[model samples]
Target: MTVKQPDLSFTQNPQWIAERETHWGPIEGFLKENNRKEVVEQLKKLFFTGVIDNPEDVREGFAILYYPLQTAEAWDYLFQDVRLNPKCFKEFMNASLMGSYNEKFFLDDEARLRFFDYFHPATYQPVIKSRVPIGREQKIVQIEVDRFEILRDMAAKFSQFLGGSEVPVIYYRLDYFFSFLDEACDVMDVSNNDKDDIQYFANNFLQRYFKIESDLEPKNRGEQKAFLVRFYNHIANNPVHPSIKAIWQKVLDEHD
Candidate 1:
């Protein structure tokens, strides 16, 4: 059975936005004095509701427009270290400034997906909706569902099961645990409230391996292999996603 993908799709091509006359690309092209008015006119009610394969090119000649200041900052942060949801974008558009530097951009299903894809930063988190209210009178507003942070928290929770300490230990033992973690987080079903349970498992795992610790320290290759072997079997014997299981298999294959 094929999983239905969520909308808000677009091809990621940095070519158009790259090597422009400026570092910010030709972002200012939409704000040209004589051209901006015509550009705004192209933004009909359904402006972003259509598919865009070549995000590098202007749509029917309409360059991507931004509210200038806050919008640019928001997009910078969105695709940068910080992640903001569509509500923040909607709010900026609501109280947009008088000049072109205002962030008055709105997103429909198609444009929202593509826009994020094109300007994607490593931290960008988007929530693609498969179903929404069907109506003519109701307005459709885009909402971003950012689980990236939560997923990291969940990964931390699992990491703690191998440690009596916090996140740094995960990085310390990333080699043994990365595949286990990459697969675990990809499942996306765990919660961040697994601290007590994690401690219980950590104690059991440490004592079983006779590596009892006051604070978790580095594990030797043998100890690491012991845990990964069980982890590999756990995935194989259980009902797991094929994609995740496949990735988990590589760690076992390569490590041996």
Candidate 2:
């Protein structure tokens, strides 16, 4: 017996995309300001009792849902008594297929798959036709979620490096390190073990390689710069683990 495939010819509405883009800018600004309480309150109101009249509201709602600083307990509390319209929720999800920023941290692959399936346009086959095949859509979402998980891990590592102090210079180094890792991974096949190794190296490199003490601020700007210079030079001269060495070489090659 031949099985029939679902028709998936309809693309996301361009109007919805425009509306989401417009709403996203202000929402991003609000989150960047780091007004946690205000953001939380606004999200609670929006999620619990607010009306989502269009795709823009859905985008705004998702922005709140995906904010990085929100803890699991906070999300649980916010969603506890919330009542969502199934139709609107489906529309919101279909319009905002990028999912949440912190989705990987908040939900595992299975949970995310469940989310996608729940809000799947396939359910409303007569009303909507997905431009993406359902199987392919799952893969796309998974890949996007994996990227988010990498970013989430990078943020966590940066926080660990911060260790309660606000230092701008360290952030630049953190960005550089992660950028190198991203670039290197793109150029080479990396396993989970390789990723773990890279992260381990990153944590140690900040303290041991750069000689930046966790509890204390750098004593001198010149010394910190000197340390970075020496570390880079050492890596350039050394034969390291293939995975890590590739990252170092990539960074050095870019600088050169």
Candidate 3:
């Protein structure tokens, strides 16, 4: 069954001023800036409401209006080391919110679904609508479930951020991960290796990247195999949208 995408509509919504003020403090001076206000209005219209109608139009609008603000430093830091920080997830959410706000203002269901397809917002939302009540407000399972949700959100957002870029440096970093993994495997093989060493290395790498704690043990061989199968299966279930792939190919070309 297909999942329904959220509608966008944030741009030009006068309510955004109050909404932003709650998080960012007083916005009198901010709202006073004509250019900034216009940008914010545009952001609300296109991002929040799905008014733009097409990803190509969105890309072009971004380039013409927003690209100057997107510095090389921002791109490099974002694609290279910035993704390692979980704090950036909030910014992504903010951007997504802005897009949806705009989309809702200017676009319809079909257009909104297209925008959702472009953004993959579902990957970042909470797993469940409400927690399953256990007893007396302890919520031990709820807390654990929430924590895992955060991790999954981070993983999905990180993948989207990297995958969303049209910058060469970004593609190089992703390609390097695959190459680095292959090279690391070859170098660490001892041939006399109990094979446990290979598992240890892979586990260690994932642990560090995923911020797994010291107490957690690597899954057994069968569990590990199942995980690999499930991860690939998940990828297969959700095909990458073509617009994103085109952006990636453009980045790859610059590298070549």
Candidate whose TM-score is highest: 2
- Indicate which candidate wins on lDDT: 2
How close is each model in CA RMSD to the real structure?
Answer: 17.6, 16.0, 20.5
Candidate 3 Cα deviation (angstroms), residue 94: 20
Please give each candidate's TM-score: 0.22, 0.26, 0.19
Worst 10 residues of 2 by lDDT: 136-145
User: Rank order by lDDT, top first?
Assistant: 2, 1, 3
Deviation in Å, model 3, residue 220 alpha carbon: 32
State the weakest 10-residue window (summed lDDT) of model 3. 127-136
For all candidates in order, the CA lDDT equals 0.35, 0.38, 0.31
- Report the error of model 3 at residue 233, Å: 32
Q: Tell me the spans in candidate 1 whose CA falls farther than 4 Å from its real position.
A: 1-25, 28-64, 69-137, 141-242
Per-residue lDDT tens digits for candidate 1, residues 88-186, read 344322222111222234322333333433322233235332122212222234545333332334344444545533222233333333343333333
Clashes of 2: 0
Q: What lDDT does model 3 reach? A: 0.31
- What TM-score does candidate 2 get on C-alpha atoms? 0.26
